[model samples]
Target: MGEENLAAVLHAAEDLRLEKWPLPEPKENEVLVRMARVGICGSDVHFLKHGRIGDFVVKKPMVIGHESSGVVVRCGKAVTSLKPGDKVALEPGVPCRHCSYCKEGIYNVCPKVSFFACPPTSGTMARYFCHPEDFCFKLPDNVSLEEGALLEPLAVGVHSCRRGGVGLGSKVLVIGAGPIGLVTLLTAKAMGAATVILTDVVEQRLEVAKKIGADGTLLTGKLNEEEIVKQIWNLFGGDGPDVALDCSGTEPGQRLAFLAPKPRGVAVMVGVGPPEIKAPLLSACLREVDIKTIFRYCNDYPAALAMLASGKVNVKQLITHNYKLEEALQAFQTARSGVGNPIKIMVHCSQ
Candidate 1:
């Protein structure tokens, strides 16, 4: 292991630098990890550009990254599940286990969670950091470190599928063909959805979604709400889909999620958008379309890894670019520019 800990730190909006952060040590129940791959998320870009995500604001310098995988360098005395030299996928958010939400097995909403790369919480875009042993899942022999890094987003898809009740012979509609939407499409198909239609404003993204396994693709670039709804119904045998997932999180996406589902179907908000958006609540209520929202993920990492090991989901296809820790700014630039339709950009943290 190297003596110097290099990290991608954000000083303020649009001010990112590679600084030497103090290497973290493992605590009684944590393990020290040498980070290998850290995937850049949309939130990371948003924070870099604006320095705030809703209420979470970056008031001081903080390390930035969350979707990461690494090898265990040292284990705390109480970390029985993992040992040195173990390769693992890190679950970023660690919640207070005593909270009511955590006790109910829905810890993703625990108000006391210390999620990586969010405002005040320092993230894992460094050579070494410490995490609770329970939050790190050992990677199967077949799963590469790159794939392990992707498990974080894949877990979101798994959680969305479960929330939307996606199952055998189901028909699903996913809005926005971005990384989250693509993963949702793959997860729905892997869960045995009979048909999965993906809608996106970007033609290139829709094309990628089709190639990956979307049963149908719709380019709703200029289409209005009614037109999109009509097109979606036509794509699903002249009827709405059994489940609709709004991965875009735009007002239009939220409205369409309620409008594009069959009566008594499910509508899930997988992406975080504005604090408030005008949605068709009355219409959804009349049709009995249940609505649900996802906050990160809970108890879904194992399922995501299992899907990867079983060859049921291939997340590597979503990765469009890669960079080293030193070239982090360039990577973020490519991601922010949307050049070449970058889907997922990965930053290698370990030498």
Candidate 2:
């Protein structure tokens, strides 16, 4: 209702400030949403702490948040799917429809895509934000705004599972136990994975994974590469898993997952880590193991929403802390510390 809305802007590395910004208006195909909850992502922390993630650099001040949900306050004349007072989850990435990637239905790989909180595109860490009407999926009455905000990350999990070819009775090993890892575990289980083994160096995170229905949790800190492989074999009852999803991008995690799967098994890399690592390619090549890597996600929002609405995936448990927009810096600090079981930290824009 006012010209200015509160926004958390990252002016420089590790220097985030809450400021007043003019509320954005909806375009012909867009809708204006009053942001309710914005989840702090690992990428957000990476950009804040290091100022850059690979090629994308924070050259200018940008609002920092992508996983978000909000209430539609205004709709453009041409917007038909959503209306004022509708609660929805914003997909955050707007791909160019003219590109071949978009035409092929894999718009997440569109080179010209504009994603929120990414280098040049401002994010939804503000009270009032405008997004394309088609990108905002209306939330069901049963889903809360908090659950809606988590749909962004859950979409990634769904996408990763789909890419990994997970299905009924599939045996899955998820490496990482972080937010994405836990979500992937949940997705696999919901997809009918008979056994889901989660591995993480953090005991607390592994404990959380066990609480979330991981058939087994492995502490990777005490095991070396070969021992880790042995443990996974044991978890699979002497037979390696059918699918191994590496949600932890660390070299060790990748190595373990690569060696822990059965011959001709599928190995999916879902986490962001170093560009290159000394992997055991010979072993993988000898076994005909299929190695696949997932980009952000493609066309997964609807499935994520459906899963949440059906109660197949309970993401609310992932949230461990909440902060007002003004306390974004502190929130980032807490996330970076990783002291307490901080699975997800949310920032309330209206607070």
Candidate 3:
């Protein structure tokens, strides 16, 4: 490999450029990886278009990818878990080990966590980047690099289902048929949920969801909130689902998360929506629905990997587009434009 490390750099809103980034060196606890597959996330498109996601604003140039898989190129002296030539999926966030939250094993909320592609921190979109050894999960022989790249989003699904207490025979409702929602549906089914219903405004996405394993799908574009809720309730035989996972993060989706769950059931917010919204909080409170939220993920990577390796969850069909590292701008444009209704756009970072 050469020292010329090319990357898709985001300068500001609508300002993405291909440039040669500095080749990073691994610290004792880190390993250098030659990136193979990088998936473009919705957050990547959001940051490129708006230069911000809530309070985290892109004030300077930064590499712009997070969902990625790579081959280990070099390992630092003290890195014992991984070795050169190993294929691994990169978990973007690395939290401070000393944080109280990290001590409690919920490092996703560590205040000083440095997550890839989140404003100031550089991401794994480049040809080569360094990541902490502990944060990278080695891929099994059965998992392709593409599937490994997808594990990042799959981890979110695993975490969301776990938070929602999806288990054997648990009925689950997922709001939105986006990437996250689809993965959540897959996870819930793999976790032995008896019924998993997904809702989305896009019929195409719902079609995809049905193909993947959603027991039922509702197209909610033409329906009002109340009607949609009633229809969702009907799906579970005149009763709300055991758990409602909101992956749309829209006001309607969040409200449904609260309203469409059985009494004393769980509602987990998996999407990043607007900072504030008018929700049916009192109604949910009165019904005793337990509201919860997931930041990124905590200790869920192994489950995601196991599911993929065991053929329990298939994410291959969700990848609708592919581009080379040089065509990253076009990839981002295609993703943003929704040309062909692409579910996942994968970028090959290695030449």
Candidate 4:
């Protein structure tokens, strides 16, 4: 028999199965990689629980993971920068360079892009996969495959901060202490935010946020919207944060993120949320508070990989659970149950 690949296939909502699939070969400009680690992203969980994210539906069985890192097993004839035995992080989305967005260097939203685990396109939750060589970035010696996988989300933090203009002496307010929020806090500080206040409904997540880099933690459970606004200003000495980043995506959270920013301050919506949202947009506009949104990330992986390698960002501490790829269903269950106070669940595939 020819070589086969083991994949974690999601057939329907909460219906994931382990199956032997065909191993892929590299194209002239592609490289075949043996996936070593895949981090479970929020969108992965959303797709499994709902079978779709807006218009992207899973009409066919698909392997379901995008945040991944692997070792190069083989390289195509045209791929010279990467060779056998190179460890690299896969940039899940491949854009057509001919598109206008790609030409503008904003290919993350290129309409024709094929993003892994997003539907029709298969993903890297398998023993082996083939991807374009240019999209697979080599990892530094100090970075682990797991850390390499995290660059995907860190890129989001980087993109969001860049859009919000987070920099030197900035006072930032981050809503939601989930993985994304924590990452934003770290990125803000790394970019020189002098003070950061983080809010979350979960105490444990707040604790983890503190351990990472948050200057202040606010448990948002008991506070009303106005109270949250009051408390946030009070935390920063009765002044609003210079920039507010909303990572919660909840209605109240989004509204509060915009409200917490100083007049003329910048606020961003980074997390994916319900299709429709109601917030104080008119009020924000009158105050000249700039409200922006973050799609996926683009052109930030190189910096993110550098940050991970130089110890500027420590994603290792964010991982709370680890399981072999064979136990992927169990890992998904743990993530969905919200039990074990799991911050991040990782699936090791190479073993």
Model 3 C-alpha lDDT per residue in residues 141-203, reported as the tens digit of each score:
899999999999999999999998899999999999999999999999999999999999999
Q: After superposition, how far is residue 194 of candidate 1 from its true place, in Å?
A: 0.7
Which candidate, 3 or 4, has the higher TM-score? 3
lDDT of each: 0.94, 0.91, 0.94, 0.90
Candidate 2 Cα errors over 4 Å, as ranges:
none
Residues 1-351, model 4: lDDT tens digits? 144698999888878899997889899999999999999988999999999999999899999999999999999999999988899999999999888999999999899999999889989999999999999999978999999888888898999999999999999999999989988998999888999889999899999988998999999899888998989999999889989999998888888977888889998999887888788888788889998999989998988888888888899898999999889999999998989988878999976
TM-score of each: 0.99, 0.98, 0.98, 0.98
lDDT rank order: 3, 1, 2, 4
> For candidate 2, lDDT tens digit of each residue in 1-351?
845788989877888888987778899999999999999999999889888899998999899999999999999999998989999999989999998999999999999999999999889999899999889999999999999999999999999999889999999999999999999998999889999999999898888999999999889897788888888889989989999999998998888767888999989989998999999989998998999999998899999999999999999999999998878778889999986668999999874
Stretches > 4 Å off in candidate 3: none
Look at candidate 4 and tell me the lDDT of residue 318.
89
The TM-score obtained by model 4 is 0.98
Clash-forming residue pairs, model 1: none
